[model samples]
Target chain A: MTSHPDVEALAFFAEELLEPDEERTVAHHIETCALCAATLDELTAVSGVLADVPPVPPMPQDVADLLDRRIDEAVRERAGSDDTATETGGPVAPVVPFTRPKKRGFNGMNLPRLMMLAAAGAVVVGGGGAVLNAVMSTQQESAVGGSAAPLLQEEQAEEAVPDAAQPYKPEIVGSGTDYTSKDLADQAADVLDATVPESGYGAEEEAQDGSILIEECAVSLGERLGVRFTLVDDARFEGAPAWVLFAPMGDTTEVYVVDPAGCESPDGVLEQETFTTR
Target chain B: MDAVQELPDRELLTRHTQGDDQAFAVLVRRHRDRLWAVAVRMMGDREEASDALQDAFLSAFRSADRFRGESQVTTWLHRIVVNACHDRLRRRKARPSTPTEDDTLDVLSNDRLGRVGGGPDHASQTEARLDVHAALETLPLDQRMALTLVDMLGYRVEEAAQILDVATGTVKSRCARGRAKLLPSLAHLRNPHPPRDVTTGRGGANPS
Candidate 1:
């Protein structure tokens, strides 16, 4: 009480934060000490100063759009397996039974596969020569037993539309330094291993954890190529930054290394490889 | 659809758990603005705030069934949002950032350049907001969050305690320390009278 209390003590006293005895002592001192009293008043006004400033402008439009898209994707993924009996009246996509083509070879083509072949044939006939060129590339790659085919077939059957039954989205797993063809094969095996145990394929993951630019690239690229990539590795290829995209086929995985800058363009694909799951 | 809009938060959450798909979206639409305010204040950057809010809502949606109705749904949402921001800030701090010029300066200049004739009042208001955010960046995260909830956002101490999952006294003490630390910078901003040349010696205690 004899000397003026410090400013922090005054701040504590204002919030009633001091010990009872100390609170009493400060209270008695500030009663007569004009300087300490003025400091206390200034400290008390801090909140008013802060509150008087206008708040940050309402959420930006792009952020709102991103939020809505993320929420919609979540709703669809959950609705696929949502067991509750209540009829959903919202504008959600009708829940489809989760299906993945098991190790059914070309000889075992079923109804969905036949439908898929019809769809691919239709694409070749109606969609123009560019799509046919893309499909023919897949056909040639499929000719290599170690390369792509069943994925193009499955992508036609499953995600014929960009929004259909996307239980898995591209998620970044790790940096892609020193990734050999062997490493790509090993990663493909891991992706297939992760898919077998659950229909959701780690659907609970924070799938959009990558930067917005990377996510948009993956999505746009998926739309262009007509396949949803399940795993994306931020990669370095030929001493340049690249992205490695993985989509699990029947028993093999299709891997593409693309330049992140021009990800939506066909020229962006720096390399393509496929390896059968062991 | 009109009826869906009229349902209360708890009813919406209950319906969401029971498989009504629209209920959660309606709940989000009703509360996103207020939650956005809390998040923007917690994280000074808009993009980071957006990311945090999305993470929180998705988490809330998934865990709606486990919410035993112990607290108001709004409080629960706020807790998730604050925790999300906390985790991001911790991870951001763990990795040292590359050196760059102050982003707040860029923001202040951009505001001035973008607005043509917003009037002096409008311009100064933006400056004040940026200044406050810059000052807030100096406090420890725990104290920053406490003061943000109690002082800037005007939540009650008890409410802040609930959101922060800390004791009432703990919230009060954190706010006290934060206020003390902020006083020197804020006083310079608020008081038009030029600061005296004489350093009160106590002024040296200012963390910034």
Candidate 2:
């Protein structure tokens, strides 16, 4: 029987065979051919001996210490620059936007402005809740069973639209007491109770509004995660102003910034914090 | 700072982008040891390695905002260190060093292969270690790096290729060639054969 010189082929494929997917092919070929199998054995043995070699001694301790010091200094310099930017309320150096193709519709909208609006929404929702409650409480007593009931129902109907679409919700908070205080609280509850379907965020205008809602959602999420969100820096990304969202996690903190370029992936966002474990 | 310390790499980087020095320090401390090893091995001298390591780390820190986390932190740092080491080597080579034949031979002797044996054989183990060191020094820089990363340091070939910025095939070929060269040198330690003419061609003559 004339057997093929499979050993040379195996030698050629030894490295490829190291990958798990190629093992079956390698094993089948080796089983039918003794020469290739022996070659594999030799390669394996050689690799084993080489593995026994010790690593070069670690870089000297003093050198490592110096590297640590230099890194610390660089980090400190960056922190100092950030602090200065925060103090002056000046634009901070932009984090490099993700080097990916820009997403559609991201160009027309201003993300930082939207983020600020979202922040304002949060403050309005949280701080205005009690005032809204007082207004609704008084209305509940006065309008127990008359034409005021229809007005309250109509107001609730207006708020039933998703938060992104309900421009009237913020207007209610802004134009405080324009409606009877009781009606405003009922309207706020109506806004909170309405569900914002993911599908509603499709049109460019809607998407921009959706982005604001998403930012609000992120803020709420951060709160739930025990992270405090602080706006520490602002810079332009891909021509749009990007806001730095700083969240303190225990003794360590995290920074998340939207990409002005509107990169689609999570990687599109920049995380530029020098964190240490407390 | 303590709050920053408890955050994960992703969170830490976010803080770093916002200009948190403590967050950057955490990243440096996390990566320094392995980066140092890569630098030291590539440069083959402690002083040069230190310089290379510091440059790489500092540059990485300055550019932390640019990091997209497409690859693991270690892989990214390794690429930086390797690039720095290559630059240093190029500069070192631009200024030549002349050594006496006796010194050259002494260095070669130090490169001898060490035996792999155990028991109360401290003397033998020490001799074997010396041999391994000598063998490592004899390899070309590329092969030496491949061997160091793949065999000794336990990096997968793909990871090593990323760090070395080479195709996987190139890493594999270098690793194979490196082992082949080291094998003969190691075998010769046991048999004491006269040195054969070493050729530079690939697969041309693997002295058995």
Q: Highest TM-score, which number? A: 1
Tell me which residue pairs clash in candidate 1. none
Per-model TM-score versus the true fold: 0.57, 0.45
Candidate 2 lDDT by residue in tens digits, A57-170: 655667666666556544443444433523532222121111211221233433333333333322211111222222233234323433223234423422332121111111
Give the Cα-based TM-score of candidate 1 against the true structure. Answer: 0.57
Clashes of each: 0, 35
Off by over 4 Å in 1: A83-278, B96-101, B107-123, B193-208
Give the least accurate 10-residue stretch of model 2 chain A, judged by summed lDDT: A164-173
Per-residue lDDT of candidate 1, residues B1-208 (tens digit): 4699998899999998887878888888888888899988887777668767876786677667767798899988888788777755543444425121146556656764666655557676776576667667678889889989999999999999998878999999898888887777676556554236312532322223
Native contact fraction (fnat) of model 1: 0.50
